[model samples]
Target: MMTHPPRPLALGTALMLASQPLWAQETQELAPVLVQERRTVLPSPAAPLHTRTALPVSVAAEQSFTRADIEALRPRDIFDLMETSLGMNITRQGSRINNFSANRGGNVSFLIDGVYLTATQAQRVVGDIPVGAVESIQFIRDGSVLSILPVMGFGSRVSSPTQGVVVINTQPAPGKAAQDRAQIKASYATYDSWSTSGSFRHSWMDGRLQLGGGYQHAASQGKPDWNMAYASDTYMLHGGWKDPDFMAMASVFINKGEREIQRYIGVLPNSSVAVGQLNSATWKYDPRDTQVFTLNLARYWNGQHTTALTYGRGKADGTAWYYATNVNPDTVAGRYFKDESTDLNLSHSIVGEQNSFKVGAQRIGYVQLTETLASAKPAPREEEIYGLYFTDEYRLTPAWAIDASARMDKKHISKGGDKYGADGSTLKLSDDTWTDKAWLLSLGTAWQINPTWRLSGRYAYSRTPTPDSITTSANQELPDERLSRWELGLDAKLHPALQASFTPFYYVIKDAKVVDSSAPKIKVFNADTGSYEALSVYTSAAEVIRKGFELSLKGRFADDMLGYEVGWSHFKDDSVTADSGTVETPKNRYTARLDWRYGPWSSTLSALRVDEYCHYFQGACLPTGDFTTVNLNISRRFEHGIKVSLYGQNLTDKRYYTRHKTGNGQTVYNLSDGALADVGATYGIEIGMDF
Candidate 1:
């Protein structure tokens, strides 16, 4: 191993000291096939990158999440992990189904390398909980935007390709100390359902090459609300090779992921009838099928400069419905939609005076092949997008810095439409193509603020299109989507080991494509549209958030008799200039946790509360609901790496849904009966030995 002396940092050089290794390609003999595997420790614990924590904010927990972060969290499910992260929020209409929608703040966008994973298909967004398959996640704020990534328009959606980027790395380096790792989990909930999975990994070649995979089978949900009760099986495959000049990671993900909820779900208005509600006999969702492939490459220019490239492909197979008799039933019903795409990107980094600049470009194209139940012809629709981007970061001082980026994109939507006469006399679909060329620009600055604080604010403008799954029409909307965002934050060192941070942000979104009418499937073009504001605060020293505030007390309180932490935040949002007044935003939320340890065992109790959030849109207002839940958890760590844990959610078994968005586009009360979850209690045990 070679190590360089600590060098003086330079301006335009904040991005240097990148991962650069000499290609040990084919330098060693082949070894027996091995199991596959999956942060920068901040010099100062308090100075986390961009304060992005969301609400129910705990004033006592200040730790951020990363690939290494999730391992300790032992998240009960994917939803729990995401909700605890900063700058990211996934809204849910009910616990039974996560159909509401998702959004991330500022320039925060999720990615598998440089590819856009969220826009691949319909109802395929909830794929969190990577199962220890995550690599290092690099959170890049609008430092650049690449076409291969998801469209970045205005709205609460995550945009600005990496003003800061969070790249979750699932591959682990090879090493010999005769090292090994294994993870196994089994869980049982109500409805006689259960799930179990296990994964193992071994490292070699100093962690240069790693391979790993996992399989899961869960007792299906036959809950009264569910249409069918069937077991689900999922398998994960991943592999990777790493060296100086060449590095690659590829995966083949096959999961039998499907769910059938009663068509008439959630709290609904009395006016709506169960015309086509999904029931035991009729409700169906073509099991979601997805295949993911990705590759990453690096070419070193010198000891001080390195360039890298990434590529990915994904395909989704499923059947969607026409809720309001919208999607021409014959075209969308019982149809097979194959969303497949290829993404490519190349990035270059160079160490400059006191800083470093990294720039890259990406392009993505998707082919949507559909076969309607009514149409014998399996027509094909192609969507193409390309982007060019660049970013520079200058380090002014060891504790202060600045970064900025710019990008441009061209999008083409090719759909086969019936012939349309140029004059308004005939009503026909035109085969004419629609292409949108847009330029996205953004800039950001990070300040150490002080010895105990760091602050960053960013502004970005982009012209991307809306997602097709949610849009009412195939006709592309060429309008530019513009956005403006501002964030100001403060972090402080209350004591030698105690830290706290507070950030308040403002957002303006416009040119969004939303369903104007459910009947007949009509879309209306609206401009300069919605606006939202958010505030987040984090205070934790513990390695995990769900562990509550115990981590902070030990860090600051130093294992005192009583140690605790509290987090609270406020998020209020609504239409900036629409007839609809303030919509209920779950943003107004708060959380507090207190944990104590009496020798070998520990107990944690947490309280979570959410202010009224927009549940249904009706009348001249958006109806909302409120939620408050309490949870209790207990765990024990024994000698020789053995552990046992137990937890209970909604201890009071509060009869409340997370959020509501009913009324079938009209105003109505909805219970989301299918989602009415019973106050749940869970128990689990783990046994491990480190030899």
Candidate 2:
């Protein structure tokens, strides 16, 4: 499919208004309207003392993005935003779809509005939430900065802290009567895609109560192809009440969407890779629906001490089908999955002139059910987690500070029911219940050497529970995966307008889980039914080590009219279990952006680069090619409360393959079939207003 530019009429109108702002000015009486500014505005969450963790400089680094940055970039989705961020690796699988790894590599935790999203819901955070609903995006690369219970609650048991954490704060209700505000935004783009979003917050009862809601709808028939069509809708509602001694808040979010299932196509012998040749012509799609609700209550007994309680419930339903060729019969397999979870958390915090302390307890219950029609097996699993944590931060001198934290967690998982195969044959299940416990600790310090330079260091130990699907040693018992990390950094202010930082870190994981295709599969046969059932399994491997360094520079010139940020990273990961030399992710990545504003016109240009790597967990270890792309956004602010933008991605229209491999890596190899592909140059336009 050919790429298209933004709609001519929209582009021309926006440019005309920006160039001739005097002609568009109006002298009309205005009510109490919210004024929009062009600087990063940090979002302050409700009950910050308990909900959001205070980022300690010695423990981890923080990256924050605000509304001004979001509007300037005009991101199509979360994927777009992350793709342009520094030290992040984003691989595009399709339009508005991507897989990402931050810093070292593993699964990152996603928290919205200070409430941890369930596993099923967390997977969609990058693609489902509208930019209008976000007040700020904060990324913390160090797990030691927060309590282990929260980190583990949002992350899978099989993943570790090396994966990093992302906190997304949604727009809160207005806190003042006159500052109440509302907005509406609409955009149209290539491939017959469009979106509409709006949100508002109003305060009443003498600024003691607030209510707000937001809605977003986005749809696309990507590239006018039968295989590339999808649509989604998102809704958010929130309410808050505040008094001198007590504060309470509640929020609800709903997301429903469907998309054509995209599967990998193998490579062809001695041929070029292209989108048209990379997909199976299967007529199938996947549908999903998810909803989540959260409530928080906090009370202040004195100026220095406060207590808080929080509760959350979430549910998700999903179903999909695809044709599998690896099996003997090339069977069409359909699967259904369900997830439900509830969480309760209690915490207390005390603040003093030179010291602070926080203590919290948490409990989480989760259930997952999976049914596959092709295999005809229904497997259900339930998990419960209980944890206690405490943190202390203190300043020892004018130039030195220290902090420490400790946490303990107990986890239990139960497998339910014997699973049946397609022929009504049942396989006897293994042990029904598994229990594990672990403790984590972190210590760090920061020193200010001079007015322009500072140094920090931290050491932490954490653990990840092994899933039941993994095979144990000769004893046939599950093992808990453990991780230890050490990091050191230097932050410097070279000039009043420029800043720089360099961080180097290393971590290791014990009992790393490795997928072994050559290992024996589990098979069970019943004499009564004269049928057999088989299951796949994984084995434990030696220690896995990951080392990395991140460097960044930021500068604002010409009195803040011009701004730029550059980030570069290098990583080396090795798994002794895989027997392979290197991990499946890239070793080098870079991202940079330049922003310029003059009068009512503003623009941002960004670039990203990712090195080649193998596909992780695919058994075949397919090697992919390197990729680089550039994006640009330009917008004009009109005097009458309207702003218009024109944006384009991959302006050069480079073609790249998503998954690449010869059939076999250890033996004779040939181009495989059905490889996945990504899109080319795309463009769009947006218009928004606030009143």
Candidate 3:
């Protein structure tokens, strides 16, 4: 494996090109197109309010990317978009594990058109969604109590406000007039990869009713000898109806895929201590499928009060193959896993002259089942969660306002089913039942000092339940994790065309969950070895603190033909116990993006820089150097609604690793991998047409 340090030359070159004045040439203005921009305002069970009214300054600190933005960036996937544009750091445990973490080893929740997905479900579906189907993506960092309502219907490890929430909307916009719209696109890139997608929408009855559907197919042959080939197909269907007093919508999404896991590269030999190694050459996931459905209904009364109801369900099934060694193909084994969940929510809201309030209640049922090739029966785990929440916004004065929210949740979990070893012998099974309760509270205030400047502050506290997967006989009764946070922000209009924001925050977590590798809690049968193996136990840490600040500046120039944005973020961690230190994450990050449009041509350039950090493994911290990468997209529109574009990623060809870890002594090997390093500089061409 090879690694490179940050390249100042690449950063400087990208900035220089962005500053060019080529867009200053005279050009004809194009027809105005209506773009829907909807922001989540209150804790409603239905979809977010479609009104254009802006949120109060105190709780308006959300970041959003529209469909137009996506078209200009041309990210390969959602994960790529988050890392390059949203300033989010992603960590993957391994290719087959499907364990993903963001920020500083924190869990982030996902919501697709008001349907919540659990962490496990998110891992399998987030990356599979067709990029062409996304309408908007929003990042709500304030941990607004309303944002957590979706997750409440589906319990998750995203307990703290610092983890944040990512809301993705895939529903197509309802045009103003009765019409039909359709588009199709195709793209081919490096590594013998290609993709094709098509979508259509039909609206009738004075634009009161709408129907749409989309399909996508993609395949890729990864780097030679890496055994990472992948392929997938996705389908979507949606319908909506709106009237003076009522609105209803429903959608269905399906995805299926298969891929071979990448092989792990060995660790650096400079270390003195010996570490475990794992052999994963024959590891892979074959025949995986996922399906999700959502329905929403809302009613308005007297234009001052509203009631809404939402229902959602999701299901996933997959098979994982593990071989004892690369040479022994005959020693292969398979494990099948299935996940299913359903939720229902009801909410009501009232508007007043000086005060606004919303209340909601929800229930969720989830189940997980797993079985080995030799097992007599599948092992099953089930969870039921119930929650209630309320939010209030009050105007103390024209220049001052206050907001508060509270939520309560209860969860019940049970585990059972038969277990068997490779030798066909019965194994010990734990049939346990447990109940947990948690709550969250938040308060915020905003003051408009003047027309150009606004100040806001907020505080939040919450308790998160432990995940069922990590629970064992030894720690099945562990206490819940507790977290608190404080944040302050200031927004300023520096100029007529420029705006800036600064935010500083402090966060603390107590009784954090951690795996105790040295303490084996239970013995699990290893099919390959035909014997029992001890598994690690879960424990709690005393405390950990994270302090960070974010700064951003964005605006348009050249009469709005050119747009630019710059952002910087920094974070520092303090752990009460060295063994419980935070995961490897950059202490500082810098990002910049420039979008230029001239006549029928449009282009976008973006860059990201990450500071060096250390990875903690086996009680040793190893340094991983910093790096920088740049990406560019340029497109041209032709007559008859035809369009063509060129996309380039990691133009600098900077090589860097996303994660560093030692494997199990016998089978798994040390590994380090990332996007640029996995496939090198990638270039692609895309063509599309609209009718």
Model 3 worst lDDT window (10 residues): 45-54
Which pairs of residues have clashing backbones in candidate 3? 276-665, 277-664, 277-665, 277-668, 278-667, 278-668, 278-669, 279-667, 279-668
lDDT of 2 by residue, 2-120 (tens): 12333345555555555654634453322332333322111122234455546654643667787788777767677678766655555554322455557676666666666665554
Q: How many clashes in candidate 1? A: 80
Question: On residues 1-691, what C-alpha lDDT tens digit does candidate 3 reach at each position?
Answer: 0123333455555555556565632243223333333222222212333221113447534677888988887887887677654436765445433444444336666778787777667777787787788988877655444533532323224333336566787885434325678999999998998999999988888778888889999999976765667899999998889877888989999999987776554445532222223234556678778899999788877566888888889887888776534457665657787778887878887777667777788787777765356453565667777888777778777667788878888766655344433333444444556546677888988876666677888887888676544433333456678878788888876675699888888888898666544452245556544544434355676787878877889999898899998888777766523343235567888888999999999999998888887765445555553778888999999998899999998898875656664433333222232221334579999999999
In order of lDDT, best first, we have: 3, 2, 1
Q: How close is candidate 2 to the true structure, as a TM-score?
A: 0.82
Query: Which parts of model 2 are misplaced by more than 4 Å?
Result: 1-48, 90-100, 148-157, 160-162, 173-178, 263-276, 281-286, 323-335, 371-378, 416-434, 472-475, 516-537, 576-583, 616-621, 657-671
Measured by lDDT, the strongest candidate is 3
Q: CA lDDT of each candidate?
A: 0.45, 0.66, 0.67
Residue-level lDDT tens digits of model 1 in 106-203? 33344553355533242253353344455444432222322224444211122223323334434443232124666676656556656677766655
TM-scores of all models? 0.70, 0.82, 0.83
What's the lDDT for candidate 3? 0.67
